[model samples]
Target chain A: MTQITSAHRKLRIILWSGAITAAVLTLGLAAFRMGDDPSHKVTYTGEADIRSQFSLTNHEGQSVTEGDYAGRWQLVFFGFTHCPDICPTTLAYMGTVLDELGPKAENVAPLFVTVDPTRDTVEILKEYVAAFHPRLIGLTGSEAQVAEAAEAFKVYYERFEEESAPAGYLMAHAGHIYLMRPDGRFEAVFLEGNQPADALAEEITIRIAKEMRS
Target chain B: MIRTVLIAATLFATPAFADVTVTAPWARASILASRPGAVYLAINADPADTLLAVSTPIAKAAMIHSVETGEDGIARMSALATLPLAAGAVVTMAPGDMHIMLTDLTEKLLEGETFPLDLTFETGGEVTIDVPILGIASKGPVEATQ
Candidate 1:
C-alpha cells in the first residue's frame, strides 16, 4: 500500500510540472504574437495599422465624422489654441503648404483637432483656426470623444499642472501631422521641424498625384 | 568745460556697458486676448552673460522658456530660471524652440502693432527692445508677408 501511494505522489508531481511548463510556454507565445501585431507598432512611414475614425464637433459646431470627408485626403493635426509656440508654428506652416498646393488643395482636408477641449470651445476654435488658414477646420469634443479620436490615430497627450502657465495648466502632445488616404487609411506622417513647408507640400502633392493615377 | 566733459563720458560709457545685442525681436499676434503670446529673438553677447529675467508692460509677467521634443515625438515646454549665453555665440530664440512666454496680456497683440520687451542680464544689465507683432502666419521677421 505504501509503495503504491509513493508512486501516485511522484506521478502527480510530474503531471503538475508538465502543466506549469505548458502554461508558461503558451503565455510566452501569446505575448510574442501580441508584440508582432501590426496595430501595436508605431512607425514613421508606410502602412501602419491606424484607423481613421473620429466623432468630433467642427468649428462650426456641427457633429462630423470621418465619413463626412470621404474621397478626400485628410491632413489631421492635434493641438490646442492656447499653445503659444509649437501649435501656431505648425498651423502657420500648414497654411503655407496648402497655399502651395494651389487647386490641388481642394483634394485635401486639413483638420486641427484640439487636445484641450476644456479651454477650446467652438467659438474659440473658429477664431483660432481662421488666424491660421481658411481651409483649416478645427475640431473639438468631449474628453471621452477626444480620447477616442486621439487613440484611433495613436496620438498621445497628457496634461500637467503648471503654476506659471495660463489657467494653471499645460498640455504636452505629439506634434505629428497624419496624412490619411481617402479610403480611411494612413498614408504618411509629417513631423514638425523635420521638413519645411515646401518640402511638405511637395510630398503631399506627390502622394495626391499618385492617388490620381491609381 | 565740466558739463561737456560729463556728457561725453556718459555717451562713451553707455556703449561700453552695452555689449549684448538683440535682433529680429518679434511676437506672434494672439488669436484671443485671453491667450498668452510668445516672443522670439536672437541674442549675441560679446562677453558672455546670463539672462536673469524678462518683463513686458503689455503682459503681467514674462518668462524665459525652452521647448524640447522628446523621442516619443512630444514637445515639452519648460521655464528656465536663467539662460546662459556663450561669448560670441548667437543664441537664437525661435518658434518651436527657446522663446519668451508672455502671460496675462493687458490687451490682444494685434497684427501690425509693436510692444516693448525688457530683458535683464546678470552682467550686461538691461536691454529694452521693441518687439513687433507680426501676423499669426508669419514665419520670421522678414517673412511677415508670406
Candidate 2:
C-alpha cells in the first residue's frame, strides 16, 4: 500500500511539471515568432511633423500656424476663391456638414487654404469664406509661404491657360477635405461627391467619441 | 410696327420658325472689386441652334466653361468655344456644371442689381437679357433673394 501511493505521487508530479514546461515553451515560441514577423513591428510616421513647419496668414492678416488651430479637430481644404464651381460647391457642402453637427461642430474647425496666392488676398479670402460659413477661416500668404504650406499638405495645383482665357488665368487643384486630430495627425479624407452632411457628421461623431475615450 | 410684327411672328410661330428663348437668368453677387462670378441660364429652342459666344459689359472677358466630375469626384472646369443645342431640347446652365465664366469684373456686382448678358447664337443672332444678381449661395432663380 505505501509503494503504490508513492508511485501515484511521482506520476502526479511528472504530469504537473510537464504541463508547466509545455506552457513556458509555447509562450517562448510565440515571443520568438512575433519578433521574426515584420507585420508585428511598429513604425512611427507622424503626419503633423510637416504641418508644424508651415506658417501662413489668415484672413485677418495675422500670421497663423498649426498652433493657432490647436485643441480642436481641423478640417482643411486647399482651394481659391476664383474657382467658380468646385470651391464654392464643396465649401457649401462643408457648411452643411458643420451645421448638421450643431453644438458638437464646435469641436471641429474648417480651414480654407488658398492654392492661388497671387490672386487670393486677405480681403478676398475674408469675403469668400463668409459666403460659405461663418466659422470658416480662409488662409493665404506670400507665394513662397503658400508653396510651403501646400507642399506640407502634399496638395497638387497647377495654373493652366486656354487659347482665349483671361489674363488672370485659372488653376487646377486636387479637391480633398482632410480631417486631422487635435494633435495634427491626419485621420481621414472626405471625397468631393460621395460626402453627404449626415454621413460626414456620423463619422466625425464616432471619431470624436473614440478620441475622447483614448 | 414692323419690329412688333416680327416679334409676334417669332413667339407665335410653329416649331419650324420658333426662336430660342433664354429664361431664369441669374448671377451671383461678387464681394471683391475684381473677382470672377458665374451666370446661369436656361435656353429653350424649338429648332436646333448653336451658342457661339457670350459677352457682358460687366466683365472684361467672358467665356463658356463646363465643369466635369472626374472619376475621383473632383470637379474641373474646361473652356468651351461653342455649345450645340438640339431642337426641342432645353439646355440649362447651372452651378457645378456648365456656366458663363465672368472674369475680371470691372466693378463689384451687388445683390439685387441687374446687368445685361449678350448671348450670340449661330443662326438666331444675339439676344441681350437682364441677369439679376443674387447672393453667392443662391442656387437658382427660386432660391434667389431679390
Candidate 3:
C-alpha cells in the first residue's frame, strides 16, 4: 500500500507539472505556428494524448460531443469562409484522399473548425464548406468559445485590409493543418508547403496501424 | 488594366508597334473528375491590334473564361465572348483574380514539369507557352499561392 501511494503521488506531481507547462505555452492569445524549427518546416511532436473535452457546434448545426469523434482519424483545418482559395483547395485535396481511400476513408474525418466564428455561423458554414468536399465538417461558436479553442490549439490569426476591402477585413492568419486520432489525441501537423497525397495517405496508415497495435 | 499597358509597351516592340508576352502563367491540375484543370496565362495585348481566342488540344472544351466572384462570394466563370487587346494592353491572370480553368485534363500534370499550351491572338499570332506544374500543398502558409 505504501509503494502504491508513493507511485500515485509521483504521477500526480508529473501531471501538475505538465499542466503548468502547457499553461505557460498557451498564452490565451493567437500564437503563430508553434513547431517551426530551423528547417522552417512543420516538425512532428508525436501524438499528444489530449484529454481536452470540447463541446462545439458542427456545420450541420448539430451538437457534437467528444464522443462523436471517438473512433476515427481527423484532419482539422482552422480557417474561414471568406478564404476564397486555400480553404477550398485543401478541402478538395483531403476529399480526394478520402475518396481514393474509399473504405479506409471511414477511418478519417475531415473537419474544418473556423477560427473566425463570428462570420462562420452554422448556416453559412453548411453551404460554404459543402462546396469543397461533402465529407468536410465546419465548426463555429461564440467569440469566447472560439478564443478558448484557438488558444488550446496554439493558432494565430489577425485581421487585415486589402485595397479591395479598405474597410478592415480578415486575411492575416497563420495557416496550419492539424491531424488527430480517434481517441482525440493530437497526432501530427502539416505546415504550409506541398505535401504529396500518397505520402500523407501512407503516413496516416502507419499511424492508424501503430495506434491499433497500441 | 493599367499595369499591363505600361509593361507591354516597354517590352520588345516592332517599328509598327506590336509586342506581346505572357506575364504570369500558372496551371492548376487536379485528379478530381468533377473539377476541371485551370491554367492561367497573362498576355500583353497591343492596343493597336486585337486578340482572338485560340485553341487547346489539352482540353475537350477550351475557351477564355471571364470569371467573377460576386458579393455572394460565389465564383462564376464564363466563356469570355471576346478578349480585347488594345495595342498596349497586357492581361494579368492570377489566382483568385483572373485565370484559365482547363477542363477534363487528358492526363496528370506532374509538378516541376512543363506542358505545351497554344494561344492564338489576333495581332501577336500563335504563341505557344510552356506551362509549368506546381505542387499544391494540403494546407498552411506554403500553400498560399495554390
Candidate 4:
C-alpha cells in the first residue's frame, strides 16, 4: 500500500507539470503573435511616431505642402474622386461635422488627398471637393509624391482591375480620417464607418478643447 | 374621356399585382460627367426572388457592386452577379454595403433630377422605378433618412 501511494503521488506531480508547461507555451505563442501583428497595435491619441509630412499640389493648380496650413488643424482624408460609395459618404458626413463645429471650424482645414493620382487631376479634384464643402481642399501630385504622403500617414491604397467596372479599374483604400494638430502632429484617427457625424463632431470638439487647454 | 384614358394608361404601366416593391431610390449627384455614380434603395419582395440585372439609360453600364471591409481595414469594391431575396424579406442597399454602380455615365447626374432605373428579377420580372438625384453626400431620400 505504501508503494502504491508513492507511485500515485509521482504520477500526479508529472501531470500537473505537463499541464503547466502547455499553458505557458500557449501564452508565449500568443504574445509573440500579438507583437508581430500590426493591426494589434492600437494607435493612441497624440502618438508621436506618425509623421504628417506631405508635398502635394492643391486643387487650384498651385504647389503646396504641409507647412502651408501650419497654424490650423488639418482634417486629412485619403480617397479618390472616382470612389462611388465610401469616399462620398465620408466626405458628406465630414461636411456635416464641420457644420456642427460652427464657428470653431475656422481653425480646422479639411484636406482631401487623392490616392488615385492617375485619374484624379487637379481640375477633377477641384470640382469633386467643391460638391462636399466649400472649405474642403483637394490635394494631388505625382505618383511618387502621393506615395510619400500616404506612407507618412500610414495609409494603404491599391488599384485593382475590374472587367465589369466603368473605369475598368477600382482603388481599394483605407477609409481612415486623420485629425492633425495645428502643429502638424497626429491627434486622432476616425474610422469612416464607425462613428456618426454628431459623435465625431463631439469628439473633435472635445479634442480641440483639450488642445486649447494644454 | 381623355382623363379616363390617361388614368388607364398609368394603371397599365404600373401593375397593381407587382410582387416587388422598391422604395427610397436615390443616387448621388456626380461631380463630373466622366465620373461614375452610385444608387441606393430598399426592396421588399412578397415571394423569394433573385435580382438578375440592372440597367439605366443615363449610364453606359450599370452593375451591382458590394463594398466589403477586410480584416486589414481596407474597403474593397467587387461586382456581384446576383442578389438573392428571401420571401417577404426586405433588402436594403446602403452607402457602405451593397449599391448599384453606374459607370461611363452619358451625362452628369445633377441634383434634383430624376432618372429611370430598370431592375430585372428572376421571378418578379422587370420593374422600372424612378430614382431621384440627391446631393453628393445625401444619405437617402429626403423623407426617408435611412
DockQ for the candidates, in order = 0.14, 0.08, 0.02, 0.15
Which model, 2 or 3, shows the larger TM-score?
2
Cα displacement (angstroms), candidate 1, residue A62, comes to 0.9
lDDT of 2 by residue, A1-214 (tens): 0111111111010001121112221110000010112222222234554352359999989999988888899889998877876677678778888898899999998999998888888988888888789999999999899888888777777787755455546777777787888877677777544444566777889889999999
Ranking by DockQ: 4, 1, 2, 3
Per-prediction TM-score: 0.82, 0.73, 0.52, 0.80
Residues A1-214, candidate 4, lDDT per residue (tens digit)? 0111111111010001121112221110000010112234333576676667999999998999999999888899999988888899888878988988888889899999999998899999988889899999999999999999999988899999998775688999988888999988899887654655666777888888988898
Q: Which residue runs of candidate 4 sit more than 4 Å off their true CA positions?
A: A1-47, B1-18, B142-146
Question: Between prediction 1 and prediction 3, which has the larger DockQ?
Answer: 1
Model 4 agreement with the true structure over B1-146: per-residue lDDT tens digits: 99999966874454333356565678988888887899987666645667899999999888889888887678999999998888667676777778999988999999999999988887667778888898776666532232
Q: Between the candidate structures 3 and 4, which one is better when assessed by lDDT?
A: 4
Q: Interface RMSD, all models, one decimal each?
A: 26.4, 31.2, 22.3, 22.1
Which residue runs does candidate 2 get wrong by more than 4 Å?
Answer: A1-53, A163-166, A191-199, B1-18, B21-23, B72-75, B142-146
RMSD in order of candidates:
23.3, 26.1, 20.3, 20.0
Model 1 per-residue lDDT at A204? 93
Model 1, range A1-214, lDDT digits (tens) per residue?
A: 0111111111010001121112221110000000112223343676567868999999999999999999999999999987888899889888989998889999999999999999999999999899889999999999999999999998999998877799888899988889999988999887655665676788899988999898
Clashes of each: 0, 0, 10, 0
Alpha carbon lDDT of each predicted model = 0.79, 0.71, 0.56, 0.77
Model 4, position A23, has a per-residue lDDT of: 25
Clashing pairs in 4: none
Q: Please say which candidate is ahead in lDDT: 1 or 2.
A: 1
Worst 10 residues of 4 chain A by lDDT: A26-35
What would the per-residue lDDT of candidate 1 be over residues B1-146, giving only the tens digit for each residue? Answer: 99999967875454334356565678999988888899987776656778889999999988888888898889888989999989767676877888898999999999889888888887767767788898887755545532
Candidate 2 residue A55 C-alpha distance from true site, Å: 2.4
Indicate the worst ten consecutive residues by lDDT in candidate 2 chain B.
B10-19
